[model samples]
Every structure is written in structure tokens, then in C-alpha cells.
Target: MTVVTSDILMDKELLHKKELANSQAALLNVLDDQKKDSEKILKKKAVDEAILASIGDGLVVVDKEGKITYVNQSFEKMLGWSSKEVLGKRIVAVVPREDEKGEEVPFNERILNKVLRGEVVVTDLTNPFYYIRKDKTRFPSSSIVTSIVLDGEIIGVVETFRDITKEKEIDKAKTEFVSLASHQLRTPLSTINWYTEMLLTGDVGKLNAEQEKYLNEVYRGNQRMVGLVNALLSVSRMDLGTFIFEPEPTDIPLLVRSVLDEQMPHIIQKGITVFPTFGTNIPLIQVDPKLLRMVVQNLLSNAIKYTPEKGKIDLSLTLTDEKKCLLFTISDTGYGIPKNQQHKIFQKLFRADNVREKDTEGTGLGLYIAKAIIDNSGGKIWFESPVSNYIEGEENVGTTFYVELPCKLLEKSK
Candidate 1:
């Protein structure tokens, strides 16, 4: 009986040991599968990163020693240096310092200190930072440097730059073209303007009624051409960043009156009646009076030109609390601009189809210039036109242009 009990205990112990061994084998298999999955995920991430680094724009990565650790194909091609030559080398060896005289200066402690202190240096206007090539030849580059940090600790910096010699040449060519074109146009325009004024003033000779009419038409056409040329010059100056603004304290009412006075002859000749309502207590605004005068003149001229004979033009100035701005509106009983074509009215070289059909002589730059002047002066412009208006026995539709300028002086008023 004692031998039989000992045999049963031995069997139970063996069985328990076998079950424990089977459980350990299962756990090992799971761990092995997990490790394989983690390695696959890691490999996928690395491939994605590699693809990103291979883009067209230059990309560089540096280590804590400010040595190039990773460089893409574009970066290598841009600087004409191989990754093998640049790896583990100090960045200063690649991008050298430039002195005030644009000479290559020796790289020293100052540059490294500033970079390590976390200064992100950027330069776009100037060109040709130094770039050392594999052949030991230095070339010009346009570059930007930004520091790389990890966990509040300075690690390294990455620089991406390009060669801009071609871009500079293109810009220089554009400037020369603008200069030459403006000069060519202005010379003949000035002569035509002077000679036309001489004829109009009878400085050359007197004339009969018909001759006077023909001469007057010639004078008007020349004047219009001069205006177009002036607009072109103004746009060119704006493009070149050389537009000058000379501002002063000016009475708004007086400026409007002066513009009306200049347009008096046109108003009378067209048989258009002017109804101007001035504000009694309007404040003087600080502005470029010449620009403001041009704005008013353009609006009034358009009104008279578009309106038929014996039509009416209404000019008004009002100050409202809602709009603490100097508001001027010029309403005319003229041919109304079509709703579809109104949006294009302020575009350069864009004339309304109706206007073009009636009058082909305009340069279509008047509203564009007026809009630009008002915008530069910190103002807004808009227009309102009725679909139809009741006339003597029918509808006489027209449009109204509204201009609103800031009451206070802009910081760049002068």
C-alpha cells in the first residue's frame, strides 16, 4: 500500500512539471512574434523618413557636434559637395563668414557663440553666402540657418540655401526696362503737351470757330494721353518701391472745391449741371493733397464723360458717427455700368464693353489709378448703381461712386 501511494505522488508531480513547461513555451512564442512586429514597424518608419529627405528642396541634418550627419541628394547637388566629404565636418568649413565688405572672413568664436546662443539667422535680400565645394572652390549662396534643439538642450543647426545669381540678373533687367520705357514715353508726351498748350493759348496764332473746335479736340486728346502716361509712370514707381508720398494738413472741402473748379470747363461744355453740397464743419485731414485731388478729378471726369448732355451730377460730403471717416460721393445721371461689368471697372486695361462701344479713346487706367491712390492713402472705395431710374417720362439709370478716407493721418502719410 505504501509503495502504491508513492507512485501516485510521483505521477502527479511529473504531470504538473509538464503543464508548467507547456505554458512557458507559449509565452516565448508570443514574445517572439511581438519582436518581429516591432522591427517591421521600425523599418517602415525609417523608409518613410528616407523618402521625405529625398525631396527636391535641400534638406540637412546635423548632430550635437554641428557636423553634417544626414544630407539629401538635392542638398549635395545644390552646394556641389558630396555627403561623404561633408559628413562629420564642422559647418563653418562649408558656410564661411562674410565681412561687411562682402569679403570672405575667417570663421572664429563669434559666429559659433551666437549660433549656440539660439539665434536663428536669416538673410534673403543679399545673395551669395560662401559655399565650399568638393573641388575646394568657394561659391556664392543664399542661405538660412536655424538651430535644432531637443529637450531644452542645444543639439545642432540645419542650413538650407540656394544659388540666386540668375534671379538677380532677371531683377536688374526688369528695372532697366521700366526706366527706359518710362523715359521714352515721357519725352514725346511732354513735347505734345507743351505744343498743344501753346496752340490753345494762341501763342502760335489765332484761329476761326471751326479751327478752334478742331484745335480744342486735339488739345483734349493730348491731355488724355498725358493722363494715361502719368498713370503708367505711377504704377511703375509703385512696382519699383519708389513711389513718393508728400503729405500735409489739408482742408478736405477746399480740395474738393479745387477739383470742381478744374472740371468747370468740361461740365459747362457737356451741358451737365453740377450740384455740390459741402459740409459746413469738416475737419482738415492729413494727406497727400495731390493724390486726393487726383482721386476727385478722376471721379468727376468719369461722371461728366459717361453722362449725356443736359444730365445732372451731384457731389456731397458727409460725416457720420458710424463711419468716422471723410466720406465723399459723386452721383451722376449718366449711362449706368452693367452689374456684371462693375467688378472689372477697377482693373488695369479693362474697359466696360458698353463704354468701349461708345468711346474707344479711353486707356481704361483711370479707375485703377484712382483706386490705387485711395488704397495707399488708407481709404476705401465702392459704388452703387440703380437698375432703373424714373426720368421725365422714362427710366434714366446711372451709377454713384463713393470714396471714404481715414480721418486721422496714417503713419506713412508723408
Candidate 2:
């Protein structure tokens, strides 16, 4: 009995030793796996840091409350602000934004704040704004702000921007060159215009019918050239921030009526039926009469020119419900702007493919100029194509342009 008990105890000891060895081996394997995971995490963090440091555009990240969290190296270098100085500060208070007129953007209107409030804000190059730097100097910048979402919730916002100082310089140079060339060309163009006018009026001896007809054609062509030169001059002035605005209490309805009268011949020639709906008690607003006249003329003429024979045009001028601004709307049964190319319609020297194919006479600067004028005058201009219902049929879809202007003159800055 004693010998049997001793053999069982010896076997139990051997089994206990084997179980301890297996446990130790499993522990070592788990430690090895943890070490590999730590190494991988560190390497990935380094790579991400390197990429953030190497980006050429300035980038900033802020929490949902608009507190600065991370600013890339480019942000520090471009804004002359060190990350240490700006970390944890309110983004809007650290950096100021200004419109083209040098008016400070209101705090509540800041894009960061809007993003925090759950509004999606996207800006393009067309709306370039100035960002003030640490030293109180400023540069024009183009930026995009996007919300950083996690688990279907917005946790923060990220903004990426780049300095467009060089772009502004290049654009100014181009405008200056255009202004000089236009000024130089005006002298010869004026001389040709005066002579052509005198010949057509028989101040010089009149020849046969053929000669008179040829001279009339020359006069009309010269007039068109003069018109183009004037448009270019106006654009150059606006771009260089030298355009002068002389605002006076102008009758909006009368202005529209005069423009319509001037364009009546062409409208009648095209057989386009006109419907003018001038709202009652439309107040006289403070605006530049000549500039306003030009705006109306461009819109009316474009509506008439693009519409086909027997097509319809509806023009309405009314005060908003608040009665603080005027709304001018013009819609036409014409070749609507193509869907894909609608975004480029207001660009300088850009014409839609449909328009270019239909009419070769346009300089493609009409809408561009009209927008520039309205924007400078504290008015807003926009358009909708294929006018609303968008029925696809034999008749081409049309476009509607809307312009809204404040009642009082706006203080503008250079």
C-alpha cells in the first residue's frame, strides 16, 4: 500500500511541472505580441506627423467649441504665429477675417462658428477674403473649412488655406496692362469712329447708295468696337479697385423703362413678347445712375438677344417684403445655360458652348461685367438656368437673373 501511494505522488508532481512550463510560454507569447503592436503604433504616428509637417498649405484644427487644437507648421509660418502662442485659443479671436471692402467680418458670421453650429460652409476662389496676421498685416487667402466627423457626429472642424498674395499681384499686373492698352487703343479707335460718323452723315461728300451703305456698316462695326473697349476699361477699373461710384436717389422703374425703350428696336425685331411687371410704390434707391443703367441694359439686351422669335420675356422690379431693398428679375425663353457649364457663366471671357454655337457676336464679358458692377455697388447678383420646372421640349430652356440692391448707399473701401 505505501509503495503504490509513492508512485501516484511522483506522477502528479511531473504533471504539475508540465502545466507551469506551458503557462510561462503562453505569457511570453502575449508579451511579444504587445511589443509588436506598440512598435507599429509609434511608426504610424511618426508617419502622420511627417505628413502634417510637410504640407504646403496652412492647416488648422479646432474642437467643436472653436478652440484651437492643432496647427500645422505651414499655419505657423504663414500667419507669423507660433503653435505655442495660439494653442487652445479661440480661432476667430486669434485670426481676423475681412471682406474686400476691409470691413471686419462679424464674430457670429465667422465660418468656424457656423461649422460648429452644424452648418456646412464651402467657399471658392471667387470669394477670396483677407486674413489678418499676428503683426497686424493681412494677405488675401483662399480657404476651405470642413467638419471632422466621428461616429456620425461632428467632433471638430479643419480648415486648409493658402496665401494668394502672388496671385493677386499677377492679377493686378494683368489689369494694369489691359488698362494701358485700352487707353492707348482708344485714341485711334476714337479717331476712326469720328471719321466714320462724319462720312455717314455726309459731312464729307456723299457718294452713291453703295458707298453710303458701306460707310454705315463701317460706322456700326466701329461702334461695336468702341463698346467693347469701354467694357474692358470698366472691368480693368473694377479689378484695380479704382472704379468710382456716384450714388444718387435714382428712380428704378424709370431707369428700367429707359433701358427697355433703348432696346425696343431689337426686341421688336426678334418678335419677343415683353411683360414688364413694375411693382407699385417702388421707392427710389441710392445707386449710381450710369452704372445702374448699364446693368439694366445688359440684362435686357441679353434677354432679347438670346430669346428666339416669338419667345417671351418677363421682367419684374419689386421691393422685398421688408421694403429695404429692390429686387429685379428677368427671365427669358432662350437657350438656357448648359447644366455642366453653368458655374462658369460669370467668369471673365467665358461663354457657354450653347451660346457660342448660337451667336458669334458676344464678347462673353457682359455677365462678368454686370456681376462686377453689382457686387461693387453693395448688391447681390445670381442666376438660375432652365428657369424652374425644366421641361425638356422643342423650345430651348431659358435663364432667369436676379439682382437685389440695398435702399441706401453703402460705404465702400479700397
Candidate 3:
């Protein structure tokens, strides 16, 4: 009986061991399937990321600790660093810094601190800081830094940068061209004005009536030529980024009235009736007086030049919205601009064909210069005219040019 019991016990133990082996094989198969699925997902993610990293613009990803977790191919190519050199390194090791004298300091200064504080920095990095290239050389760049936040927590930063050396070179060339051209044009213009004045004053010698009349014509032509040259110079200065605005607190109503006074002679000569109106107690505006004067002069000049003899021009200035802005309107009974031509009216050297045919003496630069002045002064200009052809007794159906300027532009000047 004892021998039989021992054999039975041994058989039961063998069966238990086989059952355990089968259970272990099932678990292994399940784990293998899970591993394959994870690997497939990881591969897909890597491909998507690689495509993004291959773009031309630089890209970087940092962890909450400001240590670089991932960097793109473009970023590596831009900064002369490899993945092994930059991964797990602090962002300060890669960002450029500048010294007190506006020179690159060539030291690692942390940028993530400022970014994590929720500041969006956009700057022309080419001016003071540059990216070190793979060849151990530096290149000019412009970059923007924006904070990355998740669930109200600062996670990291994203920086985009590009080389701008060529852009800077082009800007420099443009400035040089404007400076040289302005000098060349102004010199001849000054000489012309001086000589014309001398002749008109009879300082050189006395002249007969015929000679005097011819000299007067020459003087007038030269004056117009000088105005054109000056307008061109101002436009060039603006294009080259040399135009300066020195704003001062000025009375808007007074300025408009002064412009009207200066234009009175022409308004009378044209036989056009004039109506000037001012709103009660208009506030002063902060503006470059000279530039604002030009804007008003240009608008009035256009009104006078376009209006028919015996027509009317109305000028009005008013403070609106509780002294928030100064509104100016100059309406005219003129040969109204065609609807199609109105859009092109402010383009440089663009003249309405109808106006050119009627009055062949316009420079076509007045409106262009006026638009530029208004834009620089933080003002806006627009005009309204009828789309249909004009009929007799409908003289008021002409163009009305409106300008709106902010009062803050005046308050800040104070």
C-alpha cells in the first residue's frame, strides 16, 4: 500500500508542473503582441517628427527643467551642434547673448527663465546676436521666442529663427541709394531756386517787360520743380527708414485755419467759393506740425485744382466722441474722380487720366505724399464719391476726403 501511494503522489506532481508551463507560454504570447503594437506606434510617431524636423526653419523642444529633450535637423544644422552634443543640455548653452557694448558676449546665458515667465520676445537677432554655424563661424539671424504652456503650467519654449544677412545688406544698399539720390537732387534744386530768385529780384540786372515775363515763368516752373523734388526726397527718406517724426502739442483747428489762409490766394484765383467751419472747443492734437501741414495743404490743393471755376470747396474740423479724435473733412465741387481711378489715386506717379487731360500740369504726387504723411502720423484718410456720372446742378456730388486722427497722439506729446 505504501509503494502505491508514493507513485500516485509523484504522478500528481508531474501533472502540476506541466500545467504551470502551459500558463507561462500563454502569458509570453500576449506580451509579444503588446510589444509589436508599441513598436509600431513609436515608429509612426518618429516618422511624423522627422518630417517636421527636416523643415528649413529651426525648431527646439525643451522639458520643464529647461533641458533640451529634442532638437530638429534644421536647428542642429543652424547652431553647429549634433544631437549627442545638445541633448539633455540646458538651453543657455545654445542661445546667443550680447554684452554691454551691444557686442555678442559669447557666453551661455539662460533664455528659458525669461520665456517661462510668459514673455513673447520678437527681435531682429541679426543686429546684436548671431547663430554659430557648423564651421565655427557666425551668421546673422532673426528669431522669435514664445512660451509653451500646458494646463496653466509652463512646459517649455519654441524658438523660430532664420538667417537675415542678405536682408540687412539689401536694407543698407537702399539707405545708401536714398541718401545719394536726395543729395544729388537737392543740390541742383537749391541752385535753381537761388538763381531764379536773383533774376526775379533784378539783383543781377534790370530787364525789359518781355524778358521779365519769361524770367517769371522760369521762376514759377523752378518753384514747382523744387516742390516735386522735395516731395520725392521725403518719400525716399521714408522708404530708407530715415524719416523722423517730432511730435508736439498743436491746435488742430489753428493748423487747419493756417493751411486755409496759405491757400487763400489760390482759392480766390480759381473763383471757387470757400466755406470754413470749426466745431466748438476742439482739443489739440499731438503731431509733427510740418507733416500735418503738408497733409492739409495737399488735400486743399487738390480741392482747389480739381474744382471748376465758380464751384465751391467746404472745409470742416470737429472734435468727436468726447474729444477722443479730431475729424477733418474737405469736400469739393470738382470734376469728381472716376470710381475705377479712385483706387489708384494714391499710388506714386499715378494721375487720373481725366485730370491729366484737363489740367496737364499736376505732378500726381500730392495724394501719395498726403497718404504717407497721414499714415506716419497715425491717422487715416479716405474719400467718397458718387459712382454715377454727374449732372448739372449736382455740383455737391463730388469727392469728400476725410481724415481721422487720435487725440492720444497729442496727449503723449505733452
TM-scores for the candidates: 0.54, 0.88, 0.57
Q: lDDT for every model?
A: 0.74, 0.86, 0.77
Model 1 clash count equals: 1
Prediction-by-prediction clash tally: 1, 0, 1
The digit string of per-residue lDDT tens for model 2 on 205-225 reads: 867899988888888888888
Q: Sorted on TM-score, highest at the top, how do the candidates line up?
A: 2, 3, 1
Superposed on all Cα atoms, model 3 deviates from the true structure by an RMSD in Å of: 11.1
| C-alpha RMSD (angstroms) for model 1 | 12.4
| C-alpha lDDT of residue 103 in model 1 | 64
- Among the numbered candidates, top lDDT falls to 2
- What TM-score number comes out for model 3? 0.57
User: Which stretches of model 1 miss by more than 4 angstroms?
Assistant: 1-179, 199-217, 387-396, 410-414
Q: lDDT score, residue 375, model 2?
A: 85
Q: Which structure is stronger by lDDT: 1 or 2?
A: 2
Q: What's the CA RMSD of model 2 in angstroms? A: 3.7
Which ranges of candidate 3 are over 4 A from the true structure? Answer: 1-179, 388-396, 410-414
Error of 1 at 147 (Å): 38
